[model samples]
Target chain A: MQQTNRLRPFFENITFDRDDNELVLNFGPQHPSAHGQLRLMLHLQQEQVVKAHPDIGYLHRGIEKMAENMIYNEFMPTTDRTDYIAASSNNYGFALAVERLIDVKVPRRAKVIRMMLLEINRLISHLFWLATTALDIGAMTVFLYAFREREYLLDLIEDYCGARLTHSAIRIGGVPLDIPDSFLIDLKRFLDNMPQNLKDYEDLIDQNRIWKMRMENVGIIPTQMALSWGCTGPMLRASGVQWDIRKEEPYELYDEVEFDVPYSDKCDNYARYKIYMAEMRESTKILYQTIDMYKECVEKNETALMAHAPQYISAPKLDLMTQNYSLMQHFVLVTQGMRPPVGEVYAATESPKGELGYYINSQGDAYPYRLKMRAPSFWHTGVLTDLLPGSYIPDVVSIIGTTNIVFGEVDR
Target chain B: MRRYSPKDNVQKKPYYTDRYYVAPQVPKLDVESDEEFASDLAAIESKFTVSESYIQLDQLVVYIDIADNLGVLELLRDERAYTQLSELSAIDWLAKDGKFEIFYQLLSMSRRKRIRIKAYIDEAQPVKSVQSLWRSADWSEREMYDMFGIKLINHPFPKRILMPDDWEGFPLRKSYPLQGDEAASWYEVDKIFGKEHRETIGAELRDCAKVDRYDTERFSRLGFEVPKGADISGGEKRKKVQYQEDGGVFLIDRFDEEKTVIIRDKDR
Candidate 1:
């Protein structure tokens, strides 16, 4: 088939007729508002939308195929790229799935540590959403403020796991290592300081009339529709659904933790914004609780956080500590790889966007037989064409940005 | 191509209902060949059962079958309670009889349960497309089609999802060449002779000259007492020492040299 040279005749002569008044507009593959190379072919009637055909796959990198070619342990690094903003959450989800398939019990302390990283990752992911969402709407200051918090979170993560953007901290059985002493202290300080910062963020955008006008009733998705559409995380909760995997299914000691599932009936851009803000606050509270648990575990000398071996060796205490036994254990763990069972398990977590899930099938090998990732942004992005029909073209940007669709996650 | 008319630019397609976009309204399809479906599929009917099928891994190793896939997916989304079409992907069973295995993950937000849906498709058969049910399935299905050569019927525009438009055959298929577009560039005749396997004169000299070379200078440097005839007997240890010295000298040169070209043109 020959390509259509002029999609809509940008420079053609302008004329109007009443009989057949329909317009076709291509929104993006490069448009910043489309949230990562998403192109929407919009059929329009005057200013209103008649239909939106989304053209995607520009960002697709065949992550599922790559997962097949790599060893299970080798693929842990790839999880970091899935949801780059909340890398730990993706890591946790993937690791948990593998762990479930293998049937290796996660120690309580490791679970708590994983939960802490997850909560922190949620905060980081939300902060990114806030920053980019605000940027898309021309709220430049809020972008800086949101990133200010994100930078701090990344610093804390770097202190703990060494890498900021793609930390493969969580392993199959547990995390690669226990939280550093400095990491625990910094986490405590961050949790203490984040609430007031969150308040500042709300003050900046929550009450601003311009912000309200831009977001309020635009792109409304009803609770019934949201549920029917398979929306999860804030998108579903913003529609007044009280479902959260952390509370309902309670994996990774989430049952032991106390937290509230923030929800709203508004089911619009404003509702999603408010829900995410509330979630950021909730994540902060979870952080403090996690820190307290970590401290307790440290006080009790919990060996679960400590790497175990065939022979007992005192924990390295620091990564650089060079003990003969520690070196031997590290070498063995790195080369041999942990073995899990021959079953399959799906692990879900309440990610910033929604319930990010990982499904693992183990054939009793170092690598999994199959691994699948459930990205919330992809689901949320699917609803955009539905939400953009009655709304203005500019509102499309707000809807897409508010959903926080990362290309890394989408393509993966 | 149609001529540019201003009227043609005015009308846009109606955004589908959120319910339709999020979850597909699966039609009730009565499937035959019941033996291929999983026994637990009956249990999935009571809830929002998205997919209930068996995929045979090898022979008797039952996984998920594609025969009743459409029905099972409809149940998971429309009935049993799994409303979220979270993930859709395919696995290439390289040595297995089936060409590819597609995996679907469904999440029931209300019920807080997740289940996996696997479907096995033969090399040429078109797999059922779920894009109509879950709009999110659009790109996922396209990706599967692009990478695994699995056809998803009813996809709005089932084009290549990941690879470039003009790219050849499905890249992820077991039959796809592993070397990719670089198969012809894997090696060069000049590379094989010029540097890669060029044996050094010193190595040949060492092998041919059987005269024992012993030195106390090396043993003292490593804080070991020089033993008589130990240098020739400890060739392994000497080689290790040479490698370490080479590494140290290379490191020092790397730091000291400002515009040093590590490789010589003669070698290339």
Candidate 2:
């Protein structure tokens, strides 16, 4: 067949202009792959997206506003709603910020227990990411397999705290309840089983051509771009920046634990996925070490789980029941909550999602004066406007999944 | 119901204080106390004017001119190597000082130090957008506008990020009632059905707990269900809820409890 440019001038005059050919597709606020009320307004020039604007705040419950009215202790449970996937991380982040504000030192046993909960939460959240990302990328078997393991992890958290999703396991100053006797046994069992499950997941999709094709080179956030765009956690790590808050800022027993931060410089979705996989392994290593540390504390007969700052922390239940003075103090502490010093502190913790920071300003009042949740998902969501352009429409799902953004955090 | 009070001026009254309450303050150290912070401040002050700088909680806090946000942030990023803009937002100081204190938290992974650039702007004053310096500031500045109604100077697409485009008032303002204002009560009614239907919809409850379950108008009780305006003084009869239509779904089989199979064993 022979093709000629004889009618090129005639065709050029009548052909559709770039503006005329451009189409706008509204991806979500309803779609499952949108990952919880993330409405993406994608402007497409044919199959390639010209621009993407993430429309957020479908889940904004005015948590910051609510935090203002509630007492310091009351706000801990509300923090769980920020990143519901790993609720304990949100709990600990707020608790750590308040602890810093009040200058309270946690008992060693509680510190060890908090570290274990954080790592378990990291594992649970990462497994959830694995399940959902695979499900979104059209691999169903891994979703089922990943969730099967996720249930066991959630059960471990359930043993620690009563609730699974909104586990407010952490408290201001110290933990409320001591770690259960069965918890360590269950954690030891789960830590042993997690490695093989992680291996099984890699075997399922690591080398699969379609999975690689979807994730290998998609959503490449360069190292400089990531920093400028406020990327953290795996997003920052995958971009080759070796910055982890756990290592840089040692809160609780993170300084005592031995674990490596997993990072790769591929700067793509696959690198982020591999980082998440390696991080779960690292979390297992941390859990094993922390459990041993916890046992040593138990052997030393350090039974005090809550910090003994009577002015700040509530007295132990046994003391409250027996002693009238302790009961009176408990009543006062509960009625008019502990007043932190009038100062603003920006405390960042490496949440399962990213650097989940709480910028709490106190007015020497029971309630927080102004509270801002620096959610990792919010920046990751904002970066989409820059990342989504010049990519195919289908890649949007893979990118969103890899970022691991939950709207609970984004629209908080 | 509790006695009605004026909601508008609630937050205007200063926070309660007493003779017994001595406001404790966090110790703020001089910037020169930390050698690393001293150098960082020296570099920042060389090019731009710094109104005040101090170290609080190991973070260097600098109060800069609101206009010089972009220049200072650019210098920090390009020159000082403080790559990440970790947090950016405004605090409501309107009750105390009638000004909003805007803070920008910049982090340097290489140096392992944090510096905060803060500026105070009068209420409703427009602040310069740092979206050019840090891309993350795009949504953040929009959020500041959406929440506090703080206008931006030169932001590209300065629309509301959280609230709807037609939202009436700034929700995060200290004066704004936490329970909601009059405009909030009528927001959804006006949004979904237009302002003309405001009378038809009445007013939305500010508190969900106040809604009566047995009102025979809106709510439908689980066991004691009845029609919209049913007179139930004698008490409505208890009934089992029907899951499907009377004729059943066309292709779907009706469930018979006698023959229903339950997977009791785990992982069946």
Top candidate (lDDT): 2
True contacts kept of each: 0.30, 0.64
Give candidate 1 misplaced runs (Cα > 4 Å): A1-13, A19-23, A306-340, B1-65, B76-79, B177-268
TM-score of each: 0.73, 0.90
- lDDT of model 2, residue B204: 80
What is the alpha-carbon interface RMSD for each candidate?
15.8, 2.5
TM-score of chain A of each: 0.89, 0.96
Best candidate, DockQ-wise?
2
lDDT of 1 at B113: 49
Query: What's the true lDDT of residue A380 in model 1?
Result: 71
Tens-place lDDT digits, model 2, residues A107-176: 9989988898899899899999999999999999999999999999888888878788999999887788
Q: Output the lDDT of residue A103, model 1.
A: 45
**Where does model 2 sit among the CAPRI classes?**
acceptable
Residue-level lDDT of model 1, residues B11-116, one tens digit each, is 1112222333232111222322343233235545443333433322111122356766777778667766767776777776645665677777776656554556
Error of 2 at B206 (Å): 2.5
lDDT of 1 by residue, A273-358 (tens): 99999888888878778877877877887867633433212244454276776666555545544434455556677777787877
